[model samples]
Target: MNNAETLDRRALRKAAPVVGITEPGYADHSVEAGILKSIGAEVRLLRWEGKRDKLLDMLPELDVIMIRDLPLLDREAIAALPAGAGIVRYGVGVDNIDLDAARQRGIPVANVPDYGADVEVADHAAALTLALVRRVVSRARQVDNLKWNIAQQEPIYRIAGSTLGLVGFGKIARAYLARMRAFGVDDVLVYDPYVSDDYLAQYHARPASFAEICGKAQIISLHAPATAETRHLVNADTLALMNKRTCLINTSRGGLVDTDALAAALKDDKIFGAALDVLEQEPIGENCPLRGLPNVILTDHTGWYSEASVRSIQEKAALAACEILTTGVPTHWVNRW
Candidate 1:
């Protein structure tokens, strides 16, 4: 190699852009890092540890940013980035990211809406519903404590003839419906304004209002998004409408159900039991009243996870980054400039 050619290569290498990953909780970033490296881009994983100042300090150096649902990227965070830098969300929800701010800055934002997690989420919802309906978790704890024959104390109902209510009839909700049907659930009531009557008929699920589902169904599963209309959809009034034999399951967004109202209902036995995967405040707030309820089941917000799904989301997010770096536009761009 001649000295002139070597100098040209050095200049090109120095011109390569940097991609930063903020507040990453994934086990590894080899896939994303490899993708960025392939494009002659440097990859930096910035574990900010909830320090906004540290994140702000690093943003000016980045050409693209990939983040999960942590250390909120609000207006301040978005403003810290150099103009035209792209942001790629790891998963479907972009509520955590400030899309309007990104749009105002002419920075494109993208999300992986279909990263193959519907099966996992649906399976999780069904698992939580079944566990709550059968009192599995409580009974297991009782057995561990050497308590015997405690099942008779709390009346257990048959699941075969019960009515199942789905709050949203999206892909995940349809998957859940199939699973519930396997258990011989006779009636399926769905409440989704966007879904058509023909679609409900195709699944043999009846279309009903949200209030009707809350009042009439034996098992109500929430699969709605977090929006102004859906926020606190299941509040005190809806909780009151629920039958005493009903078991509520939420594997969707936490904002769909009001935690305070649910806590009150559970305390008074207004509803039979409730299972929740996502909480309004993650890690659960210190004052969360649902913590010690015997009739309530709680799981970390991990319903949309599996070994395969994790890899898929990482690859898709990385691909979005790759697209942005190569063409100044992502394949799944959400915030159009």
Candidate 2:
């Protein structure tokens, strides 16, 4: 063989599989690099600038992709994926990914569902709930502005005898209930249709309709996924059903609540207050009405975040990528062809 042809063959034989990250957010890629190296794969940051061109440019070289918050992987993007490539979402929610498209293309898609973020999210939900009920955030702002003795100005109800409501009975919801129960939340009305009555009874919670939860519970927390059915689950009708003194807490998907409806409710004092760790539009749009609302507290979707949680998710996601690259099978496969 010619010298050039021999060198080309040698290079092809030594090529390593590349695992690209849609957008690199972590301090370093050491964890992903270490895990995927065992399977002869290297990690590459796509550095996707929220543009389709950036994704298309990187798709050809990637054998697997690990995604976090941005860059929605739609059908077009799925079509551009390398043959036999796989996708692994960094966290639980795969709403940003096109699972059906990946399935049709015979590309396996997986998510790290049990990376120990349940505790962090549940704790964050409880913290938001407390801040909402006790007027902690608002009161702190008031105190910062030199306003004191405002207890009666903004009524702070006792949580000891109030009822708690959970929109979903998942691991995070159950953990949140455990925390609220300590604060004397004896009555818990759950609105998850998927959970059985016996299952809820084990947690001393009773199943209730959505309207009943809004009408009866003094504090309602949402923990549902963002599917078509669950999108805007908290809208005008549901918000209208809520007692005026009720507080809403959402640490789950932002799409679960209608931002406009929620803004109107808070403006009219339809509900007592709301503390949100997630928003319909992240980084919050400039025109968002909830921006300066005293009755609303907004956070930048940090409920599922912690130093430990970040590391755990990174490790789990890398392991999933390694598994898929080595065996063509992911641990928590979402798209099973």
* 11-121: candidate 2 lDDT, tens digit per residue: 443358889987647888889889888878878888877778978878977778889877788988888986567899999999988988887766788899999878999
- Model 2: ten consecutive residues of lowest lDDT: 1-10
Q: Cα lDDT for residue 323, model 1?
A: 80
The digit string of per-residue lDDT tens for model 1 on 283-337 reads 7886899998999999998899999999999889988988876776688988875
Give the lDDT of residue 95 in candidate 2: 91
Compared with the true structure, model 2 gives a TM-score of 0.94
User: What residue pairs are clashing in model 2?
Assistant: none
Off by over 4 Å in 1: 1-14
Best by TM-score: 2
> Native-vs-model 1 lDDT?
0.86
After superposition on all CA atoms, what RMSD does each candidate show versus the true structure? Answer: 5.7, 5.4
Model 1 is weakest, by summed lDDT over 10 consecutive residues, at 1-10
